[model samples]
Target chain A: MAKIKNLAELRKMREEQQKQLNLREKSNDPEKYVQIKVGMATSGIASGAKRIMDFLIVELDKRGIEAVVTQTGDMGYCYAEPTIEVTRPGEEPIVFGYVDTQRADEIIEKYIKNGELVEGIIPVNYESID
Target chain B: MAQQLKMQLLVCGGTGCRASESESIEAALARELKAHGLENEAKVITTGCFGFCEKGPIVKVHPDNTFYTQVTPADAREIVEEHVLKGRKVERLLYTDPENKEHVPDSRHMGFYRKQIRIALRNCGFINPENIDEYLARDGYEALGKCLAEMTPDAVIDIMKKSGLRGRGGGGFPTGLKWEITRKSVADQKYVVCNADEGDPGAFMDRSILEGDPHAILEAMAICGYAIGATKGLIYIRAEYPLAIKRLKIAIDQAMEYGLLGKNIFETGFDFDVELRYGAGAFVCGEETALIHSMEGSRGEPTFKPPFPSVEGYMGKPTNVNNVETFANVPIIINKGADWFASIGTERSKGTKVFALAGKINNVGLIEVPMGTTLREVIFEIGGGIKDGKEFKAVQTGGPSGGCLTQKHLDIPIEYETLVEAGSMMGSGGMIVMDEDDCMVSMAKFYLEFTVEESCGKCSPCRIGNKRLHEMLETVTEGKATMETLEKLKNLSNVIKDTSLCGLGQTAPNPVLSTLNNFWDEYLEHVEDHKCRAGACKSLMRYVIIPDNCVGCTACARNCPVNCISGERKQVHEIDQSTCIKCGTCMEKCKFNAIEIV
Candidate 1:
């Protein structure tokens, strides 16, 4: 990382970086990667979603799990907060609610690594556009 | 390579559910799964608010999207045994509609959420806000990327000006015009600011957005920086919002790491980064000038404005400031074109407004409805009418700074212009529904008291006018005021509104003026007849025990804290007016309906 001198050099460097980013994104199948989606919606944030999301990302890497993590807005379930939605290849995405750091660690070890369902599995009994 | 599968459980983590012990419910479900040796089989997650807040704590099992409402710790064992173990939906905990008693399996199909168009609250309960990648998946920075890649600084301002999206934080000022003013201003350094200092009582619309979607504000500010050619953004949030502040910090840090913020954003040569500045719980700081002053480490006070924040603000540089709710709507407007954003709201006021629907309303939560949605629809259809089947009297919009609108104004469309025309301004969209039991005279006094305390005392109008107004209200409510005092109140209110320096002093007289206009008869009755119709004014009200209805039940006598009630075994109880202290305990305790407020 070098200090950006002026706007022109900054634009050139950005263009090069964007090209690399596009190439990487194009080469890899986004859906194929183990997608870990956390609910950071207003209700979710009120319920401490940031802490759980932070815990999961750091812990997942520490545990040597190769996964792609991201955030989305409200899933409409404002009651159960700090919700995380995890999807593996060729399987339906599952949503877990009321996740803390302890639960995030368990989710990474059991659900992400061992392919097992952990506690706090909130069954989606409704139709959602997402 | 061995592929591993994962499960996601989305729980409604809104404040409504959290108060119902949703945290405990989450813990119990986890414990139960671990105990049953199925901990490896499931993963529990918490998400942002599910809209239906009444039947919370709501648990939704994803992939299947099984919606469970009113889940308790006691029901966790059964949920694990029945749902997780046997792969069957728990029949008991599922949400049953109150109208027809039919089980609603999906939240989308629920009658409550069928009409809602969730744009501001798009990523609230779905993605983890702490992760920048999840924001990326939802096309978060694509707008910023588009703005930087193709559009120039002036062009971005032009698009926003055409969008017609006004500020949602009380005053409906055009957001683009503010940006344009800031962009055109000559300054060596410029700044972008987010006003998360929401101080309106019972208003949590800003709080919910910050908690659920902090990334949106970050993204919007970054885009604003690119448009205004600023490299830094500051979010001045109240220290009271711990969850919101924490999430905002996390989101900012994560954005910096992902190259969404800091230096070049999305490889578009836009270097914008946001920092958090917490307020020490001052109500007046909600005003932009006051907010800028506070950020400059001065006491939160409003200054005389010829040069607004857009011209000269925040360390005396050209700054653009919008509240949390206003910034929340920016991303959607840019992503889905200006016309699409302009189409939903009223002719003048564009896009939806998020209201903290509270006070006697059934749906006591955060609701975002398009501007021009009638108060009747919001109160009756959406809010499910008043609690305990009470007659609707008035709906107070805009907190202490707004006027109280009666049932006559219910059909008037709720836009900035219409609301102001109806003797009320949409001050941050805090609609507090009041029933017939609420006394208008007393309500006016209550809001006046709030304004008097929150006044910055910089000017004479707010400081002196609020005191005089409060004294007059007190006199009227105490049955001591005359018609002459009423005239004084009217004259004083007008002077205050006209002479005030800032919005706080200007709108301080709204409650007094609006109440006097709508509930003039109520005030006259209190002064002329010396009677409080609602029995709310303690000085004017008296508790009388009726002999016919009294069965000599000693309940009222025993419950009276001041020992005001006296009666024989078989006769009626009498409340001694002198000793009563007007506590109304005897009135509440009389089971035989003996006691009445006169």
Candidate 2:
């Protein structure tokens, strides 16, 4: 830790440290950021969902995208094994099925950064009670 | 690196929650997280007061947003295993609504926090206070940086004046005006003082701010130093608040390390330093003059204010003193602009007030609500009404020096002028609610006892006057005062209020005066009727044995300490009222509901 020499240094240090608290800031208002929910139930974990979730978390930060990545219970898509739900601000959520680390990268690059639909799209087959 | 953290377990590390083993809860959560290998995925951070202290030690799981109340250290494993691993909420630990018996998921939906604005307490429960990085992440010293880099001294003061923030330390004096007064005062050495000696009985708002966001106070003080042209700052805090003192020391050290407090702060050639002066928890020291006197190693007694602390404060120099909560609001006002801070509260009073909500309230905690909020909304909606479904009675705002307001005053907006008009001043935001069982006379007596004990005795009106007032209240509660005594009590209270020197003596008689005005009939019952409706005054109560209900009931006679009950076997008993001590032991021992108090 260096002594803050001036206002510029203080402001720069604050910006660097602000990123450390970005997860908390994003969770406070999930709608303002890109929200990704990884299915982490037994079925999802059996298909290496943990690696994909970790990959998404690290890559999203590296790419300088404001996003919240959280784990959900079974999305009731056991057949897909590893699935993820991606919901942009004020939009319908899109679930991608059988997501390996490569597919997760593709989802981030195309669907998230470019706003383009990618392969392995799992459409909503059931309706919520609400 | 921040994105790696998937969840946050925010354990409340406030003094109240710490007393309830929140430290162990934090440790337990950490251990459980390690056991599950989720330490990296989930972070355990101990935050300051959530203000929901009744249900503490509170464990709030962030990102998922699960608020668990009254969480024991043993419940940590279940939280990590169920909530963290399986993404499921612990059902039993959730806060159940006292009304609907439904489990509240998070703090947002709960009635306790629903009405709160939380300006002063914004980063309190959210960020880790001890960690300076966390503070910096929340734009901690950005206000100081902005003020130094862009704004002039007058510009900063102008912004504060426009924000309309008054002193939260009971005076309600404009903070900007106080700074301006000190700025104008010509002195070789100027001082900026923070009055952290919060002596109100049920008040901990200052303590919470100091403990939770100490950096905010340092930042605000530096900003004040810049405004008032003071190089030296002193925090006059009470010795009783050990945790607050500890955190303040840490924050000052951190700020100094960052070159935010020491010489040449922000490399702008402005040198400012802050030091802490501990008081012996004297109530009079909360007054600015007395606080300065104490800081100067003199007796903590207030002198007349012809030359106010702004002109002649510590060592007879120009000084600007602000409360902890008042300083806590400064950085935000600077960051968000004056109009943003001014828009929330009432016409005269701006920004939210943090109150330590206590006494007969269902959710006894700390709350920050906007001005002009009705007492009814605070007590019923936010405070969760009176405890045990009891009928609402009078509420004593302020502390010993404040007045008690009754049911009719509930709808009045809680502004500075409004509270003073309703026979109570918002003295440091100690809102103590009373239930139907609480006798107003006894309540007044309780406050008088505090004033009598805490009085500095510098003035006869306060020292001798409060003593006499306490004795008079004693006689009234003991059912020994005549109508003449009541009249004398009223006159003496007025005299004390008029002749007292400082704010302490001036407001010492408020409890007595307010209760006398509001609950006159209850006081009259003690004097004339010799009856206490609430049965709080034991001297006014006469224990009588119901003739028809009693059947010999030697059980009561056997249990009576004074042997006041007399009866033959299988016959109705009579209670010897003169001999009875009113201990209620006979009443408890009566198997047949025989003993009754009249």
Candidate 3:
């Protein structure tokens, strides 16, 4: 580690560390960041949902996007194995079906980064009450 | 690929939780995470006190915010497997509300944390105190860097003055004014002192802050050093706080290596450094004058105030002394502007006050609540009410120097002036709640006994007056004092308060005076009827056997250590009143619920 020489140096170090050290901070207010939930039930896992979840987790950070990627039970879209729901800040959650690494990257680039929609959109048919 | 933390397991490393083996719990968590190959995915960080000490060791899972209480080392495996792996909360370990008996998974829903506003304790239970990087990540030394690079000495002092922060060490003096006074004093060698000598009984607020976030103190002291035009800073911490001392040393070394502490910090041509001065844990040394004296290798006794510490402190050089909690709040006030802090608390007392809540309370822990939070809210809402479904008798604030506040004073907002007006000073924020079972007369005697023991015998008023005060309390509790004795007790307490030289001697008689003012009826009963309603005064209590209820099993007679109970087997017993020792051992031995204290 280098010694902080000036205000600019300290600020630079803080800004760099803040990004890497923001997991706990992001968790505090998930709504402020991009929240992604992957289906991880038995049926979903049999269809390589684990690989897709890992791909999303690694790819999102590599792209310098702040996000909380958590796993949930089957979103009742067993027909579309490896389903994922993406909720951007102040936006409604959108479910994308048959999400592989390719589609996950497209979702990150088109949907998450630019707020543009891509194909394989699964419209909500049920109201999930909290 | 950079290691992305999906989850963080925050195990409480505060002194209270550590006593319950939180360190082993942290290791067990790390081990379980390693066994499952989820070590990098989920990080287990040993943070400072979570403040919910009643149910510890506490393991809080971040992102999901699942709060697990009373966790043992053995439960770590299940937490890593179930909570970490499967994203399932451990049902049994959740904090069950004392009112509804419903398990609350998150801390946000619990009554203990709902009303608290953590400012002084902002980084306490969050970051690893040993790592300066984590502290930096949370804008740790930004205040010092900002102060050195941008603001002038007077400019920084103006911010402190506008923030309305008082000295959290029970004196309620304006912190900025103290700094200004020291800055005005013409001394080539002025000093900034952080008073970490927290000697209040049952108070660990300062100790927790030091152990949890030592850098906060270091940074604040440097900021004070800059504001007061002082190059040297000393932390007068008690030697008993080994963990705090260790952490402070680590923080100091780390800050120096980072070029944040020693000389020419931030290349701003400002040099400020801090070192620790250990107190022998004398309660009187908590006072600034006594603390300065003790640091100077002299007697730990306070001197008269016209030449205050800010004027002629620490080798006759102007020295500024502030409490640990007061220093802890400085960085936050500087980071978030004065108005932001000034908006949280009451008019006179700004920012939050950290209190070590103990005694007969459901949640006995360290809590920081904003000023003007009522006693009812702290005792009932945040404290989870009295323990064992008992009625609250009185709440004692400010340690031995503070006074007891009864039920009538519950609704008053807890500002410094309000507490003092209600016959109690906020002396280091030790709030001990007393339940119905605690006797008021005996409670006053208990505090008097502590004062008698801790009173630095520098003045005759404190040395002799407090000793005589304790004797009068003894006489009252023993049921031998008349009404004339009570009058003398009140008169002597006032004399001690008026004639004493220092704050310790001045406030030593508060408990006696306050209890006498609040529970005069209880005192009358002890003196006139020769009976203690609470049964706390043993001498005033008599053990009598209920004739009808006695089974005559000879248990009481056989177990009586002094042979006070005499009866043959299969016959009712009779207690010899003259020979009874009031030990109440026979009461425990009775099987038929025969013996009762009258």
Candidate 4:
């Protein structure tokens, strides 16, 4: 809780923090987790994709959904931005598009929670080198 | 069980595409779908910029990925009827390769995108940046979590140092060195600042990223804080970027609620958070020192830097500042290891640089290419050559601060060192391609005018020097400047560049000097003959009608504002050279193949 007064103390603190960071990385299960991918290509952002991605995270947490979230460079379907791909343990990834905060919330409740496909489910329009 | 059916139309909504009225096309598509009773089956969704901006207003039909280009509002009904209802691809709207005239089915087949390796621009058009979980799913903060748990603050800094990532924010400062300096400097508080003040003309790379992938910046800054032992970050974005700022605010709020930003991020006890500070549209604030001063509620002016921001910045504390593009690259470098990044770019410039490829080029949008990519490839191959088949005169990299490079420098690799060697600096990646139609003298004058307006006036050299330089350019354009005036202009430019307090003032003369060196003949013609070679200087140009080609319907006379043309209806119009104001309205209005600029 004290302020670091010198370089030596700061160096010591940094080392101690690194040890803690190492432990966290070691414990993460990369394969067992569900992944959500958001498209962030230039076209995607212009279409308000950032807002949709933010909404999904907050709504998912409120509903106690356990998933790993991340952003990918343009998925080439810039036209279908604010695009989201939801992947569960045994299910094929379901990609949705043109998602807003409201649609994102509905997706969490109907599709993510109750296993129902709601509106705005954008089928992968184009084949990319996934 | 009822079969669930749904269709989505994703439209290219980037600025380049929008300029061609992509929004109108989107609206039309939605309206047609509804009219056809397929509104329930189809939903029109707007998304971020797909990088292939040349063939834009791009429409992709979902589930099948039928890529359509140049879709106007008129074609929206057919798209809804044929593509949505009949399930047939719209063959005419497909992008045909210029060389082979082959209809490219998908983005993968396009030559423009085949060579690109997107990192910083990774998430731009892909996901909703507002959604925190979507960002989480893409392994966004896994690097942050990984850094918090496994890596020491020193280790994180070490990895960044080894990554060979230089600042994309024009200065090319080593990212690792900056962090080390800030981390070493002892202060009651340290800060991480993301300079989103992208003021370079024709540059929108940072704006697109902030709009599409706000979280990437957030995640990168958090990682930066954890590495440098800083707990607070500030994003100094321009107020002009309304959409980018809105998304950034949303991303920040979402990160905080999900425990990604505030104390104990991923339970690591690293209390770091970010806040946004809007810049008042000052170009100087793009500089780190000026940016820090602006954040501290002071005038956005550059100061002498012996104690760099790394030693004492914003509110006089140790601070690390990186631009939007710089921070966008961090998460990848940390996640993929330093060697992976170092291997991608040239030996010295080790990463992809994003450019707002504008002016004369066919593809006027954001493009990210490797450091060693040639100017020729970017201008001709990727940009689809010059617009209207105009001859490539020169390409101006680094905005007003950078020099104009001609065809001789076309094949030179676009690295920072090579650009500098070519008499230009690889500034914040604004590559404005100029064609033969562009008057170099006038171009220089245009840029000088902009610099004159933007100078903060704190320093004498920039304020006074730029005003005088602008006046000289105006004189040259008006055919009133003498050879003596030209010499004075050159001398003043050198003094301003050498003595100016900040980057804004220092580089104000780049446009003038570069044009003078490359297009000295044009200037000579202007002074000696009082003629604008490109016919761009209105005062030096006159509109004349050729007798043979003119079947005069009085079109020119009717359109002339100053009554410069004295001719009856159905007679060849005679333009009175003495009375002519040289507005060129007569030339544009004349339907006959008669009007010529002399």
Candidate 5:
């Protein structure tokens, strides 16, 4: 690892580093890029959230899609262990459930790239606090 | 550059999960991946504590985001074969709702994570703690960078003030005010100290933050140093937290190597370095003044304020002391504007608080929620209600210095002021839920005993007054106390609270006062009726036989360990009140369920 010369160098390194990680931070500018959050709590990990997150990252990057996928702690949807919340440009975040590789592929290809909804959509049940 | 991998599996490497053999799970997953010749396609990463430690050894699969819980090393083979090879989620490892038989596949729908906001613990469970790049990728040091580059020390303090961030070290002091006081104090050499002693018995959110995201503390400390015009920082942590210590050392070394710390930071001529100091973990030493005294090689006992740590701290120089969780929130407050934080929590306490939810909780773990969130939301909604479907009795927060809150206070929003009004304080965010089985009087005694042990003895009111209070509660539990002793208990506890030297002694009687106020009827039952309705105080309960239910069962007579049951065979069993012990073995032995406690 090289010593970062300044904040710019550090920021540059972080931008590159973030690509390897599925960084799913919610951004104020929703139209910038697609953001995906995979539930990676204990249940998520035991059910194989790491694999799904990695697959989404690698496959999305491979497919030349602009997206940020990251690991989020339990979103309280433990019933949907392999769950991912996908938000495309200027759209609401939609949570999907029990996403096996087949579902992950369809989610990325249809929902992400072509802007179409697919199966395994886990409805958001919680009401936001004022 | 190489393309992204096809799949990834993340195993929880938290202390709880590691104790449950998550390491073996990680190794087994890697081996399985290698055996399948998919090592290049799939990756296995071990992250930090997921905060859901109740069901540990958690494994998460990426690409599809499958969450599996309570996974042992033995299940790794099937996880790899079925889940990894064929992309089928291993159904057995999934968390099945205890109430409902439905298997929960994602953590998002779980009751534990729904109401939680996770501000202080934002980066905790998600990333690998050891990797500096991972920390940086999450906009980690951007706060410090922004502080040094754009904002002046006063400007940074202004942002903190506007954010309304209070000290999460149980003090509830305004963080910005503490910084401003230290900044105004005249000193040549100043220091910024992070109090990570976290001596609360069941509290570990501080420990988790250190282990999960050590860089967060380091980054926040640097920002603090920058904000307070100090170049040296110290972390006063407990020796018991070896993992947190090791991770902090790694983060410091990495930051130093990356030019994030130690001289000419960001090429802005700003220099800051962080060092670690281990404490014996005296609960009283959590007080900032005492903590500073301990750091300075003086007596660990707390001294009077006005000369508070901000004015006279760390070798008698101006200093700033903040809790680990307090500092953990700094970087985020800087990165995102103060208003972003101020918008989340209540008007007074403008951010989320990380609570170590333990004791009689269905989902016992760390949860960070917005400050305005209610106790009902925490205990029932996020904690999955009381354990075993028992009725909730009370919750003890703020460690020994805090008081117990009853069911009537459940709906009240959990702000610092709100908790204080309810005869409880949110001390370091330790929420220990107690069920109906727990006795309020004994619960007060339990906290009093802890206070008696941890008292610095710097003052006599706490030393003598707390002892007397305990003796009264002790006598009450033994069913030997009169109503006069109960009055003495309340009076003595008030004296202790009023005259104690430090926060330790000042708030020592909170448990006794709070319990007596909340459960006065229970206390009356113990003193007047000589009965413990909860059956928690064993000496107050007696073992007897209901004559109607006793159908000449000799089993009670034979099983009585002390031969206290003297009735002959084919006759109603009678437990001799004088000689009988309250062991309840006769109750267990009686096939007719004749024996009962009267």
Candidate 6:
């Protein structure tokens, strides 16, 4: 937490910071861990994304799943509330829609834990905003 | 440790969403979480504008990425109980895609976000603007650090020039050139000015940027200070933007604490600092000279531009001024090479421009797209088309300064040069989409009315010419305008453009001229037929009782505030045209759909 004195120090700090922001996974290698991105736009949040988020993090830790969860800006599917794009190790990110606490736990148990898909899978038809 | 572990619930606390009770939504969420004893496991936080104001009061659940739209405070308990406790997604609250009628569970799949590439607005809805750590975690200050330690003033300016980032503040002047001019200006004291005074009628992009990502502006300003050899930076934001001003103050203080701004920043011995100056929200103060004058405690009036603000600004010192969005683009441009930035937009205008997408559009919010993205894409793909399936008639870009572009110009790539060449300059990106219902004459009058009121009156052409333009528009909408008045309006607008002292006067007649060019037939219909086809101008429209539809139930007569409807009960009724108020109350009250407008 010291003040960055030079460019080298700043770069080092950025490296550490980048690891923390590893939730975003700029490398795009899904094999590292289970990656989950919560649609955090106004629409998603208004439809109870908060509740779903709390459920996912708590249940994941309790269930002992090695998943890195992060908040991302809107991907434009506002009609779908409590949506999450889940990427298992060495798998394509499959987005699930209308995720409640029950769905969140089911996804962590079946999808993240057992590598099985669940209901409310939002079909991906467009490229994500990189 | 507990704070970061638990799921983070981000509620939009932007001005628009906050007005729609997002604060109460946040508080309701917090209360509901505690009631269920999940408060410790769930953290409810208020972030900045989510840009999608139409579907505001957004609640985003982290890790799962559940995007909830149009959430009410009443839905808080159900959210906590069903979604939080029972792990069940709320069915009714989910946003139903207009196209497929499918419940879209993710924001990434929405039509509104398909084409948008968020750079200037990257952090808007994602991060809490008040938090310094959040900003730092997003690679915020690294640009400033790199600029100071790695690149010289000339080198930094060269990158900016190569990036081809023109000013997002309407004029489309090159940002690098502006900085170089300031760098070359021999001055005892130099300054970096951030123009946060966004005065366009429908535009809120700048305000949202400040509220959503205040640190972006600060970091960019610090870099500008280093690039232009300035020690002091000033953000001249309007006083009307209370939320933006509040967020900016927090960001500046946090930057100072983190050694990002002020003395010895990034250990590079760069003694740059940012200060906030509040404007009274004068529309003319958006002009650089007027903004500088307003900052220096003078009347917000723009003088001649032989010596632009770069040469002499802010108490007659060399100052470099960049609009909020322009600065927001600076950091990423430096981080991701000039080529990376330049490759996104058109040949002339590189990087993206943030637009406050408003008016009759389905997705009324803020958006950032690459410069060449056509108006059609913005209106349909990103905007989710016009609201209520209304046919798009025209779109007014750049507020009063820009022109009205019709269906023909939809495919034209929206660059600064293209917009200006098509008779509309890309003024501070405010795209107000008009529908079939919107009267062109009335729309023109509305803009001219704004200009006439906001003109500083320092120049006679703007003062008198804009007023005359407004009057002619008024006459047209009233169906009393002669052909001579139209000719007079056009000639007067040209004269105003030529003789104006500043940008305010120079572009004041754009709406009138643009509307006249794009919607000439609509104007002629008003002047010749004495009718408004769109039924927008109340004066040119008349309320009538359809004889075939009228049941003579006396509903129309009873409901008419002016008692214009006459005829016996259960018989064919007629609306007394002369006495009718055109309030449409009778039409609304009539269950039989009896009333019609002629």
The Cα error of candidate 3 at residue B278, in Å, is 1.0
Winner by DockQ between candidate 5 and candidate 1: 5
Considering every candidate listed, which one attains the maximal DockQ? 2
* Chain B TM-score, one value per candidate, order as shown: 0.92, 0.98, 0.97, 0.90, 0.96, 0.93
lDDT of model 3 at residue B460? 98
Clashing pairs in 2: none
Model 5, total clashes: 57
C-alpha lDDT values of all predictions? 0.79, 0.90, 0.90, 0.80, 0.85, 0.84
Residue B166 in candidate 3, Cα distance off native in Å: 0.6
Residue-wise C-alpha lDDT for candidate 2, range A59-116, written one tens digit per residue: 9888988888888889988898699999998888999998998889999999998789
lDDT of 1: 0.79
**Tens-place lDDT digits, model 3, residues B496-520:** 9999999898999999899989999
- The DockQ-based CAPRI class assigned to model 4 is incorrect
- State the lDDT at A69 in candidate 5: 64
Worst 10 residues of 2 chain A by lDDT: A20-29
Candidate achieving higher DockQ, 2 or 4: 2
Instruction: Give model 6's TM-score versus the native structure.
Output: 0.84
Instruction: Give candidate 5 regions above 4 Å deviation.
Output: A23-64, A67-130, B1-4, B98-100, B549-563, B568-570
lDDT of 5 by residue, B98-205 (tens): 778777766766777778887889887677898898899999798888888888999999999999999999888999999999999888989999999998878998
Off by over 4 Å in 6: A8-130, B1-6, B35-40, B543-596
Docking class of 1: incorrect
Clashing pairs in 3: none
Error of 2 at B404 (Å): 1.6
Chain A only: TM-score of every candidate? 0.74, 0.93, 0.85, 0.69, 0.75, 0.73
Accuracy of chain B in candidate 1 (TM-score): 0.92
Q: In Å, what is the interface RMSD of model 3?
A: 2.3
List per-candidate RMSD values in Å.
Answer: 10.9, 1.8, 2.1, 11.5, 6.8, 7.6
Model 6: per-residue Cα lDDT over B1-598, one tens digit each = 2433445677998999888899899999999999977887667877878777878878876544567899999989988776665445676777778888887765776787778899999888877888877777788788888898889999999999999999999998999999999999999999999998898889999999999999999999999999999999999998889999899998888878777888999777789899999999899999989999999999999999878878888888999999999999999999898999989988888888888999999989988889899999998988899899989999999898888999999999989999998989888989999999999889988998899999999989998888888888888888789999889889999999999999888888888898889888988899999999898898888877778988788887887788777899789988777777788898789888867778
Error (Å) of candidate 6 at residue A21 is 4.9
Residue-level lDDT of model 4, residues B1-598, one tens digit each, is 1111235677866666778898899899999987987675567766667766766778865544457888898999988776665445677998888889888865656767666778889866555566655465566676787788789999999999999899998879999999998899998899999999998888888988887789999989999998887999999999988878888898888878767788777666788999999999888889889899898899988899878999989899889999899999999898899999999889999989998888998877678898899998888888889999889999988998999999999999888898888888899989899898888899998888888888889999999999999999999998998999889888999999999998999999998998888888999888888988777888898778999888868888888889889877777779998899888798788777799988
Q: Which is the leading candidate under TM-score?
A: 2
What is the TM-score, restricted to chain A, for candidate 6? 0.73
